[model samples]
Target chain A: MAAQKNNYRILTIVSLLLLLVFIGFAENHLDLYIVRILNVCAIYAILGMSMNLINGFTGLFSLGHAGFMAVGAYTTALLTIPPAIKAQIFYLAPLIKPLDQMNLPFPVALFVGGLLAAVVGGLIAAPTLRLKGDYLAIATLGFAEIIRVVFTNTQTITNGALGLKGIPALTNLWWSFGAAAFTLVVLLSLINSSYGRALKAIREDEIAAESMGIHLAKHKTLSFVIGAFFAGIGGGLLGNLLGTIDPKMFSFTFTFNILLIIVLGGMGSFSGSIISAFIVTIANEYLRFLDESIKVGMRSVVFSALLMFVVLFYRHGLMGANEFSWERLFGNKVYQKTLGRWTKRPRKGGYAG
Target chain B: MTLDLFLQHLSNGISLGSLYALIAIGYTMVYGVLRLINFAHGDIFMMATYFAFFGIVTFRIPWFITFPLVLVLTAALGMTVEAVAYRPIREAPKISILISAIGASFFLENLTIVLFGGVPKPFPAPTLFTDVVQVGTVAIQKLTFYIPIVTVLSLLALLYLINKTKTGMAMRAVSMDQETARVMGININHTIAFTFGLGSFLAAVGGIMWGMKFPQIQPLMGVIPGLKCFIAAVIGGIGNIGGAVIGGFILGIGEIMLVAFLPNLTGYRDAFAFVLLILILLSKPTGILGEKTAEKV
Candidate 1:
């Protein structure tokens, strides 16, 4: 067991080093298109991991990620847009005072954006956490729509339907990958902690967890707020990457896309989310031909079909709450025996001949 | 606001409310029987409109023939959807069923988008329904009068079907306790399918009237109205048909009043349903007419 722990530690370091080298290589040499896809994959990884934390780990079925993302994207976008550009974009309504003049560095803006989202999450969670199951889902979905509507009507602040453009492209591969890695580390550690066990306990049986003296509301709110924070950061990254954002972009469809990712990845598995994020993103891009020739919605049809298939046949998703570990890969006796059998079979046949 | 404008808004609200009532009945009935939200209820409503569109535009059928044909087709479509997407998971976890419903909803929407091309098509509104009737200072569409009458008639018919029929008894029994209902020799599958059929039929009627009023249809048009109707159903107490109608009227009138009085907030119209829903949910989760049922541990 000690040897296995050491192996895992070494594996973690090796993977981190490999990721760093890949980022360095991609930053300097990779084509713009490839880098953009990688950036999207990283952003989706952040989104998937955050969603998994709440829906998968905490057993909360909230569908308010889009609303949180909208808040974050708008905050970051409003903060980072040049004052001159802000004036131009808010042509319909004058830019609000103080906000028009305010600007911040990318990292600070992203952090503030996430913080604001977390605040919003907490506020929403206060009233909504009392509701359970599908009621919570619908309430959160309602909140998301309310956020979008508010954003659309508050033209002075969000530029309304006109949307914001010319957001500085500050979300490079390095930033996205860095944020994704940070989210993975934080969430993994949090999940392995006693607090995570409490969350899982709550998920398994809320009544029992409460009996055991776990503060259901407090832990549920914590997981929800943290999830919302990262979702906000991911949203900020996406907005910067796309260079524009509108209220329409943060609709339930966006939430459904992220839901599809987490569901396909295995609701509670961080590694599963990461893998499925890349697969779904790349598959979406590669499937453009189907849309171009047949119809514009073929991709969505395919995705919805895949979602149905997964829900119907593979409810546990790809990882089923399990993580990939080096110990399992190299230290399992059954695997070693199988490897030995395969290697020796051919030699045994030759000797018999 | 002047009484004249208020009357105009009132008539408009009633017309919209009746449509919501029609749609909400379907949601309520399905929820009553299956204890499922049937998220695809909206998409089913949308498909009804498209079916009507195709009946008139593609098949060149008269309004008299096309309307009934669309209703039957949509009812059949709803049953098929239930059989294909929902039947297999009838005994599964509620959440799994919900996911399947959502998936089915998305499938119908995206499939429509692919087949119909994403652009909005002008609905073929018959001249009879679209004509404006002047009432002194108030001008109302002919539909404003017809819709409420149709809604009342449908409600009466549904009530009669539920109260005075063998199938209704079966449905009630199944909803109360599926295991007991099965032991009593009720065909659970058939009853559920019939319930879906009834709900879809109402949705079809609502969809046709909605198309006449809006005069435009798109693949995604049903989403908002579907959600709003579901909210109406919830507010009225999800499983109660009469409550759904009342809830629908209240929502409709309240929404129109909000827009009429606060014209600046017209953009926030869609948000109204959600806010109302959240308030109702927080304050009274069982809804106005919903009875509290204890869950068995």
Candidate 2:
């Protein structure tokens, strides 16, 4: 067993070193388009992981993710944009008095934006955490709509519908991948901890967990706030990478994209989310030919069809309820080709709510 | 506000409310029976309008023949959706079913975007409905007067069907307990499909009226109205038909009044419905007329 463990350890280190070498090579040699796709994949991976933490692990059907992302993106944009550029963009109405002159470094601005999103998440979770199932879904959806309306009206703070441009391009391959890696490590550890067990218990049966002496409110709140924080950071990274943003960009459709990633990845598995993120985002770009050659919006037709196929036939998705470790990772390729199932032991009836 | 203007607003509000009531009836029926939100319910309403648009504009059918054709097509579409997208996953987890429903909704929307150009098209409201008459300083479209009558008549007919018909009894039975209904030989699939068809028939009526009132149509037009109608259904109590009509009037009137009373806050008009929804949800989680259903372990 010790020898097997040592072999696994050596494999893990070798893979990590190889990944670093690839990133280094790609950063210096890759074309702008390829680099941009890579950056977006990492950001999406972060959003997917965070969303999966709440929706997949905690089993709370919250759809307020786009609202949180908007909060974070707007905050980060306002803080990082120079005052002169802010003046140029807010031609209709000058930015609010407080935000006009204030600017911070990219890292600090990102953190502050994530912090604000976390605070907003906490406030939203307090009232909404009591509801369950479809009711909870509708209520959270309502909250997101309310937030969007408020942002559209609050012209001074958000620049209203005019949006902000000329945001500095501070997020690169390093920043996005680093954040994604950080999210993976944190969420992976959390899922393995006792706290994660409590979350799983709550997800499986809230009343049962409450009976087992788990504090439902506290744990739920923690998970929501953390998820919002990372989602905010992911939003901030996306904004910087794109260099322009508006309220319309953070609509429910944006949340739907992240939801798609988690669902495709097997909502319960972070490893799956990370892998699926790359596949879906890359597939989306490559499938542009279907749109360009045949008709506009055909790509989405393919995706929605694929999503339905997965939900109906492969309800467990790519990884089912299992996670990726060294043994599973090495075994996955041969096993996937040789067998239909991902694991030797098929655990039936476990689903990501 | 002048009394004439008040009367004008009242007529407009009621017209809008009745349309909301019609769509909400469809939403409530599906939600009440399957315990699914029918996220595609709104998309189905969107398709009904497109069907009518094609019937009248593309095929150049006369209004009288086209309207009934649209209703039948819409009902058939709803049933097809239930059979293809929903039936296979009937045994899946609730969340998965919900996901499938959302997927179905997006598929319809994007498919429409591809098939029909994204540009808005004039809805071609018939001159008969668009005609206006002045009554004591208040000018109202003839269709405005026709809306409430249709809603009331539909409501009565629906109540009679639910109370008197065998199919309605089967619907209520399946909703009450699917397992028991199956054992009782209710033919659950046919009954559910029939419920979808009936609900979608109502959505077609609502969508046609909405096109008349709004005077223009686009691919994404049903999104906001669909959400508002769903909210109306929730407020009225999900399963109660009467409650849906009441909730519709409340929302439609409430929205107009907020804009009228507070002109400065006119920009926040859309937010009003959602705020009302959250308040209603928090105060009465079972909804205004919904029964408290105990969660099964």
Candidate 3:
């Protein structure tokens, strides 16, 4: 146990050191264009983590994550924009007195933005969580689309999809890492908690969990709200990163991309999501050269074909129910087998705690 | 807006809704049977429109010959998709199939994009079909009339196929209980493939009609309509054929009405479907005609 504790500390330190070095290099060495892309990748990682919380760790199938992010982006944009500029931008309507006058600090705006998104996510969960399997996926997809439309139509609030610009650039490299770190810590704690156990139970077997007296609605809602909260923060970060906001930016494609990340990462594995998020973001950014010559929908064809291949042959995803750990990297065969056996053994079906 | 404008908008709404219903029927039917949301259905619909477009433009075929040919060919293509793309993973976990569906959807869209350039193609709308009819005070194009008629006829035909035919009976059997259907010697694979073919045929009809009505086709055009129709299917209680039609109409009309009433919210038109989707998902996941189903596991 002592050795294991020491090993974990060393791993954490090494990972943090690598991350700091990468960020330092990004900040100093890379040009603004590259930095911007890196920031976008970081934002996607944030969104991916938000999705990973519900879809991966909690075992929920949500396709509307982009909807919540849109909410966050719009909220942050609405809250942080200067009153004079907002009035100029949305000349057709009078601004909300509170929103116009108020411009909170960046962290506060992100927090409130996330909180608002979480509220919406919670409300959505109230009805959607009752659904199981594909129903939930469709429901969430609808919600995401609905959110986009709402932003587009609520011209008084969202500026009607012409998009909100002039958002405060408060998201630096440090801020993004801060949010990512906070999300990772919160998710880690939640996944290891009793609530986490209940969520896992619901994912594995809902009926069995209900039979064991676990309040299915409560735990599911908790996960949904938490996921939405982070997704919203990610959205806010994204808004600041881009320095522009539009409803079109948070479309079904946006949701689909993040969904791809969680699916490609082993579902329910935090480390898997982190790695896959980076992989997917980079692959999409760089791999456009492969099909750049193709006509309008051709790139989507190749991407989708890859997705089909993955689903057909590798349902387990890139990690295949494995977490990123030094032991696997260093070839600790005995520890890996033991960990594998632990995850595979089906527990007796009972109510979630 | 004057009464004529209102009527015109209403006509547009109905035409749009009818087309949506046509596409939604396919999605709802497949969802009913396989419990898989065929994401590729939208791409298939796009491909069908291209088939019709190519049949008319490339082959220089008349609408009379092209329309029927497109329907048959598209339906066959859909079945082929089922055979090639989805067949191997039928027994896999539902999530895997769902992912495969997404993949297939992307693959088709991208492949089409690569094959057909991204520039929106001006689909051939025969002048005869484009002729405006002044009915009472409202002036409407012939295609507007054709859209609703085609949608209704297809819906009737689909209803007949499902309710009054042996194949429909097999489809119902498979949807309700696949294991029981197989036990009863119903060919699960055949029925599923047939369901896809039938659905694709409807999608082709919608695609062709959409091309005629909008008269502009792009590879990505099917994405929004496909999503909206899926919402319609959900609202109509997925798997319920009649419900899919109703859902389609509601979605189509509601969107136009939203834009008409709140002209300022024209950009919010896409959001209307999504908002309705969330509302329906919240209040009635079973949809208007859908029965509630809980997994035994």
Chain A TM-scores, per candidate, are 0.92, 0.93, 0.89
Per-residue accuracy of model 2 over A216-297 as CA lDDT, tens digit each: 9999998999999999999899999999998888887888888888999997889889989999999999999999998999
Q: In terms of TM-score, which candidate is strongest?
A: 2
CA error at residue A171 for candidate 1, angstroms: 0.5
**lDDT by candidate, in order shown:** 0.91, 0.88, 0.84
**Which one wins on lDDT?**
1
lDDT: the better of candidates 1 and 3: 1
Deviating ranges (above 4 Å) for candidate 3: A1-8, A81-95, A291-299, A332-353, B1-13, B163-165, B253-268, B281-284, B292-297
Clashes by residue pair, model 1: none
> What lDDT score goes with residue B167 in model 3?
94
Q: Taking chain A of candidate 2, what TM-score results?
A: 0.93
Q: How large an RMSD does model 2 have?
A: 4.1
Cα misplacement distance, residue B257 of candidate 2 (Å): 1.0
**Candidate with maximal DockQ:** 2
Query: Lowest summed-lDDT stretch of 10 residues in model 3 chain B?
Result: B265-274
Task: Name the regions of candidate 1 deviating beyond 4 angstroms.
Answer: A1-5, A328-353
For model 3, the docking class works out as medium
State the local distance difference test value for candidate 1. 0.91
